[model samples]
Target: MSVTASQVHGAVQTLTQSSDTLFLLLGAIMVFLMHAGFAFLEVGTVRHKNQVNALVKILADFGISALAYFFIGYWVAYGANFFADAQTLSQGNGYELVKFFFLLTFAAAIPAIVSGGIAERARFYPILVATFFTVGLVYPVFEGMIWNGNFGLQAWFESQFGYGFHDFAGSVVVHGVGGWIALVAVLFLGMRKGRIRAGKHTNFAPSNIPFLALGAWILCVGWFGFNVMSAQTLNGISGLVAMNSLMAMVGGIVAALIAGKNDPGFIHNGPLAGLVAICAGSDLMHPIGSLITGAVAGALFVYLFTYLQNKTKIDDVLGVWPLHGVCGAWGGIAAGIFGQTALGGLGGVSFVVQLLGTLVGIGIAVGGALVVYGIINKVSGLRLSEEDEFNGADLAIHKISATSDD
Candidate 1:
């Protein structure tokens, strides 16, 4: 029997959709691994007693994020839902399902980012509650505005600035939002016990530098997926994003090394700062521009992290506000600068538009965080008791230490 042209065309179309779905699935899986990176990073940074809590919070936040996003967040952002039957959902090789999974990884990252800031003393259930509302409501609203174009926000920007906002991969959408929200939570929670003695900052050295290094390495590796897979489809994928990511990572590492004066923690985090800054413009900027962006972001992390810890005595435990909040914002705005033709970039981004988009994200994040964390603080309270705090979250929360001999 001869296959007709229609049959052949249908086969090819199915094959293409299947390939795209697989591509997205792999991307989702890779991003899911970044949660591990987040976990390890926190584990390495927090005191030994709090290490288990750090590990648990990352995993728990991801689980909570998955549920919230699946049931509420996705629909809130995109006006879509999983109320459809599996047969209907599986259409297009289940691309939509895989897309949800991919984006869920990003949504979950918000709580993970916060985990670092509030670690050591936050009540676990309260943080989970915050995660539920955050992923379910706050994050999705802005996410929809930027990615799904739910509101006329992007259109409004274009009307005024000659271009819509240009966050190609959520420097502002994910990292910046997560960072700013983390800041509010950190402020509300206040410094960890013993974090400040007198008016000066007290040093609580990282529990494990090797573990910290490992976490940084994992994040660095997984970020490629975080950046590259952001294209969402095979046809949209670009080598440029990957190259830019690499250059930016390298630039951050080098800059942090110099600015941090060979501090190991700073050295590891340098690459992350660079990657964060380059995400918004990776597709459009020259590699050199990405390198500069990354370098600046890396230096920013070193300076801000130090200043906050020593000068202000704001105990952002892992400096999420600096690493994610500020660097992420810088990256979003930098996209506008580096993505212009005059600066060896592709020239569709408007600086003013990018600036406004970033500000909006930050504003929403601050408001949401204050509301969520504030209410949670007022209602159930957000901190462990002083006894629990002194005992370490391992025994207080998890009933065991990470390295328990028994």
Candidate 2:
């Protein structure tokens, strides 16, 4: 039988759609596993008494995030609804469905970031409520603005700056938003009971270095999918993004290793800081520019974390604010600088646009968190009672404690 041109086109389209769908499904799965990274990272950083709580909060919050995003957040972000019958929704080889799943993983990351910052003290139910609102309403508003062009902001940027603000993998949209929101929640919760006494900061060592290291490793490995698969289709994929991400990650490790004076926590977290910063410009920069960006992010995380911990009263349990918020913001700005052709980058982003966009995302995050957490504090309360907190969140809240051997 002779194949018509139309038939050939249709077959090619089908294959392309199937490939893209599988690609995104794999990316979603990788990102989903990052939640485990989040859980163990928090578990290791917190006291043993709170280990169970850390794990529980991350998993539960992910559940809440899925419902909120599937039912509400996705529509808000894209103005698309899944109200259609399954047959209709499954069109295009179900690429749209998998797309939602991919984005849902990113949306859920907001709560994962917050869990680390507020671990050991936050009440379980109240934090879950925060996750619902943050994922459903606050995060989607900005996600819509940047990714879907829901607002006129992108249009205005293109009109004036020659390009819209670029965030290849959500440095600002996901990490920045999550980080700043975590900062607000951290401030609201105040210091953990004995974090600061007599104006002296107390050090609470990690309960398990191995677990923390494992979490970092998972995040680092999964981040390839996070950054590269952001292309969303086989046609858009670029090896440069992968190369830049690797360079930035190593850059972060080396910078943190030096800046942190051989601190293992800093070393493990360094790659995360670099990855966060490189997310925005990963598609646009030379590997060298990416390395510098990651290095700057790593050093900035180390210094800001130290300053926030020892010189300030901020009790950010896992330094979420610095790791996500600060590094994310740096990523946004670095994209503008390193994405310029003058700097051996792709040359589309504007520094001013990047700055404005980053600031707006941060503002929205802070504002949304304040409203959600403030109301929860007033109505339902945000933290465990003094006695419950003293007993460790595991036994106090979950009634299951990890014994020393376990």
Candidate 3:
């Protein structure tokens, strides 16, 4: 049978829709795998007694964020149709459904970061409360305004600042927000046992290098979907994003090797740093730019983790700030330099405006997290009882012992 003009047009439309759906699905799968990465990473970093607690937190955050995103979180972030003037969202029903899954993944990052902060000793209920607020309110409200085409903060920045800060994916929206929350939670939860002494620090080797390796690998791989899908258009952009991501990870690995003085633990985290760095402009920058960004991010992780560990006595059970906060900041700034329209319009942001917007994002992220964590601490109390902390949260709180008797 001869193909009519109408048939050709219908075929094209079907192909286009199918392509969009495929990309969305790919993004969802990659994001989900990052949870497994977190599980191994967190469990490996903490003591054996607390391993189960950390792992449980990772699982809980992933599950809770999924449900929360499906319910109120997705609507808050992308459901502007809940309000009028959400024209772009209204045009496609699929966009609405995809938005929920996307935001769920994004919102999960904050709770994941916070998990490291409260690890080893916190009561699970307090963490549950914090997760509820972060997914349901903090992340969705701000990021929704950014991507949903609303004439709110992002638009205001673009109008007044001559260039809005462009995080091609979610360096600022996801990783930055997560890091800030982790920082605040760390403050409220206080130091873990043996972390603070008179004037010196002790080395706490990861319980399992294999676990750390696995988590870092998962995060690095998933990042391709996380960063690339943010562009959300069918074309060569996904390839570029993936390429940038890979190069950045390579650069990070090299940087970590050099900075760590050949330590395996430091080298292991390099991939995560690279992934986080590229997250800001995976679709907007060339491979060379990713190389530079990734190296810097990897170096920053080394410095931040070491300094914070010894100086502040902040026992980041999984080094969340180093991987998420520092690298996430690098990714956002890199977008300003490499996001030229020649690339993907990410570098088109003016330096000054991008700086301002970045600061505003940082402020919102850090300040909101501080306030939220403080309140949670006040209401539910952030850490476990002193005796409980010494005994380990896994057994103390959950009754899941680390010993063979279990």
- Which predicted model would earn the best lDDT? 2
Give residue 264's error in model 2 in angstroms: 0.5
96 Cα displacement, candidate 2 (Å): 0.2
**Steric clash pairs (candidate 3):** 339-346, 339-347, 340-347
Superior candidate under lDDT, 1 versus 2: 2
TM-score of candidate 3 to 2 decimals: 0.91
Please list the residue runs of candidate 3 whose C-alpha ends up more than 4 Å from where it truly belongs after superposition.
Answer: 1-3, 80-95, 340-347, 402-406
Candidate 1 regions with alpha-carbon error over 4 angstroms? none
lDDT of 3: 0.77
TM-score of each: 0.98, 0.98, 0.91
Task: TM-score for candidate 1, please give it.
Answer: 0.98
Poorest lDDT segment (10 consecutive residues) of candidate 3: 80-89
Q: lDDT tens string, model 1, 113-202?
A: 999988898999999999999999999999999888878998898788888888777788999999999999988888888876776678
Q: What is the lDDT of residue 219 in candidate 2?
A: 96
In candidate 2, how many clashes are counted? 0
RMSD vs true structure, all candidates: 1.0, 1.0, 3.4
For candidate 3, the per-residue lDDT at 317 reads 65
Cα lDDT tens digits for candidate 3, 7-40: 9998888787767766776787788788888788
Worst 10 residues of 1 by lDDT: 194-203
Consecutive 10-residue window with the lowest summed lDDT within model 2: 397-406
